[model samples]
Target: MGQREIRACWFGAGVLVGAMAASLCAMRAMARARADVSADLSPEVSPEVSPAALPVEDAARAPSAAPESGADMFEYRGFVVHLFWQALAPARYKAWCDIWEAGAVVQEAGGPPATYPTAAEARMAGGAWARHWIQNNG
Candidate 1:
């Protein structure tokens, strides 16, 4: 091909490389957040940063104070489901979606707020946060 075509090919390659790098960086950050959330699962852990207790969107923007209902807790990839707490008063609490490749939570929604036993499990349940439960106590 001509020099112009060669230059265009290089430019396209550069863009692809850049996108891949960005994706990787995002995945690493998600993994870190997941780790941080798991590591500090103590009474001292601040409620402000906890995923389970996320505050509703700005009140000024909304008309009512009522909590959102039937909202999915998490969403990642194409999976979506509700999470329920089988052993507690508020059986259904929050939801979360797993960005499986990123090793982190892609999204999360309302629930009673409990640290997940495993990151993998939590991620898998993304888009199904309202159905969270202690699958195994071990």
Candidate 2:
């Protein structure tokens, strides 16, 4: 296979691994949350208590503020795109982007292996790649 194809294959594998890790983390978190809720239940408290029985503080709260604006971040087609770059060598950089909707990650788009001498270039590449992905997949 070509170098570009090989890079894409590796990057795709990385994304899959990352997605699995995130799912495992979410599962563990859900289990912990369930345990916490169960521990909060006392022998006197019925498992099927009505909402009216809940204290005023138990009511759902308001949503948080929106994300701040920046050069490497922007909203596109109802999705929040965040761009980031890492220095891989003295004159080489790598970039990736995460797309979010409803405050959760939708996907990660990794930039091509093109030489990026500056962080700005890397971020631009990543953002472009992410936008294209969104156009076809979003």
Task: Tell me the TM-score of each prediction against the true structure.
Answer: 0.33, 0.45
- Cα-based lDDT at residue 107, candidate 1: 30
Q: Pick the candidate with the highest TM-score.
A: 2
Error of 1 at 7 (Å): 0.7
In model 1, which runs have C-alpha deviations exceeding 4 angstroms?
A: 43-138
RMSD of each: 15.8, 14.0
Q: State residue 6's C-alpha deviation in candidate 1, in Å.
A: 0.4
Query: Model 2, range 99-120, lDDT digits (tens) per residue?
Result: 8887557895555667587766
Question: lDDT per residue, candidate 1, 1-138, as tens digits?
Answer: 999999888877875885596567556645654564445455544435534444444322222212222222343343343332221122232333222223222333334345444333343343334334222110
Candidate 1 global lDDT: 0.39
The regions of model 2 sitting more than 4 angstroms off are 1-71, 113-115
